[model samples]
Target: MADARAANERRVRRLEQMKTNGSAGAASGTLKAFWHGGRKPAHIVVRSALLKRVEGGNILTRLVLPRGVALRFYLLALFEAQCRLAVGGQWENVLPLSGPGSWSDMIASDGAYDGKSGTYMRGTRGGRAAEDLRLRQVQGALRTLEEVGGERPDQALVEVPRGPRGQRLYPSFRLLQESGRGSHQSPDIYTVPTDHWHPSRTVTIPAAFFLNGWVQVLSPSEVATWLALRVLSKWAPEKHQESGVFLYGDARKQQFGLRRDAWEDGCQRLLNFGLIRFARPMKDGDPAVPPTPNSWLMDFDQPEPRERYEPHRYQVIDEGLDQDAVRVCHRELTLRQHALDRRAAEVQSRKNGGPQQDVWPQWDGGEREMRFEEV
Candidate 1:
């Protein structure tokens, strides 16, 4: 523990020194480096086909996700873990897809919805009104499994080691391992590495965003669009935390095979959710030259203003119908982002030999020793 803390301190100091002296990785007055201790990255590994169906404007509504944040978190975690398990392994045959995650980290059920799966009420996590919300989330996940692996009912996704007594738990899926090489291939050729980088394409997102109940209410397409934007965010300004830093042009869209209508809907969903802010919708007149992708600014973690919000056309799942169901997503995101801001400030302050309010800001596992176990 001491060594780890010391290493973190050194890393902190090195980053501070770099930015202060305008050395490598220095940006305007801030550093664009990953903090020593910060947001817990939910490593996600997605296949190209899934995103195409979800984000690239698939017409089928069969695999549409349930608007529950908890289930979404489970899916993201499972997908990420499964990707890690795929590499260097038997990805060629009927692959058993699963990922290991603690209940607390994934669901945040706090033992409220432990044993009761079907008989559970709307008050599953929050209140009486939330009962249906939670149920639909479970349904969405089950349907997703059916969409992927329906031929064999026994092989369908299901939770293991059922929850204790009355406690409820989330549903899991078991899809027929995706298409790979021939069945005759030697077993030695396929083994998934536990590490993240082994997968050719993977992106790390803050766990809070997916787990936050606000994001859970979005349609699956909207979620994919948000994720697509995140992928596009890599091209944004690396040094600053501000949004509207990157552009998403026609070439990139063409390469990804993302249709304009799909792209518009995705961005519109994000805008309505207040996740991203567009200064202006795309301007008219232009088939020859691709317009600069500067109209939209990323607002995932940026602070939202208190003034009257712009006229938003998108509506929440239970908008105007339920009372407690409308947990202001923008407010939740703003708070999470605020916590992140404090973290960045602490890093800068500590480097300057000043005191830090909370030494560990986002999520802390610095004290936990590294261990490897079979999933």
Candidate 2:
């Protein structure tokens, strides 16, 4: 375990070094200016309508359930590509043409141009296998996106049926329109409407998501979870507090169709990656255990402890990718693990007819002091 941790630390240090060194290059300098101006992180704007549940289900929910992290990434890439092109005017109707090279560039990796083959090749230690797998994933994701909208043409349009009394219906509302089948060589064209009626309702994705070595590390489910939380923050700004955004009830499941286990795992991983933190410790009352043998039991069997339903409040850390932030995240994760272990031990002890152990120590106020250094 210690070795693994050390290796991860070394990897992070290498990424930081690469970022520092690469900033001097002309291309990197250009990207740095366009992405974030070397200060605030660059952000991707996604239309809220894509996440909305129309008559034919939500596009994002469909992508989430199928474990479509790559697809989601592709969607983000499309938006990013469009945003870049929009600067040249024709922001609304123009469809940006993107190929594999454009898509792969969005992710941080070591790659070189193969002059002989006239293709860009990934420069990973895993060799050909890894490169092939990466290409396949990207291509597969593109195909899936095409199929998703292709099967239901009506999904791109909003239209109501004609009334029996000859009443007129409002004009159709178009959300997203796609053209041409995308491929590794020739990419597809996607158009998003920009009009007053269908105003742009967007969610801002932290630029670090693509630039800060996170895209390579975060799993598909983890990415989905992060995006879902961001969407929630935009949808219900009132729920935002200093502690974080409180996620309660079956809203995530009902709205996003994220399974309970998947959601939990995603959140756990995001926490581990230092991209997110729980606003508070999630503690619950112990379940009732079978009573031990007694004469007739004492006067008032302790009133059943009321079940506590503490919703998880999560704060997405946008900046502070320094070592201090990493250490704090590591400490919090360790504490959480210890608490889980203690809870399991207590449960087993009660089942074996042994005395329940004392409650684990709760998180202290010091966690509130957790801070990350802005890059």
What lDDT would candidate 2 get against the real structure? 0.45
Q: How do the residues 258-295 of candidate 2 rate in per-residue lDDT, one tens digit apiece?
A: 56666776776666656677765533442222222231
RMSD each, Å? 19.9, 14.8
Q: What overall lDDT goes with each candidate model?
A: 0.35, 0.45
Runs off by more than 4 Å, candidate 1? 1-49, 52-62, 65-76, 79-140, 148-200, 235-262, 279-326, 330-375
For each candidate in turn, the TM-score is 0.37, 0.51
The residue-by-residue lDDT of candidate 1 on 181-292, one tens digit each, is 1134221122333333412233334433433433334445556555555544443333113323222343224333444555555554355445665433322331112223
Candidate 2 segments exceeding 4 Å error: 1-41, 55-57, 65-69, 87-101, 105-133, 149-200, 236-238, 280-308, 320-375
Q: Candidate 1, after superposition: displacement of residue 3 in Å? A: 59
How much is 342 displaced in model 1, in angstroms? 40
Single out the weakest 10-residue window by summed lDDT for candidate 1: 27-36
**Backbone Cα, N, C clashes tallied per candidate:** 21, 0
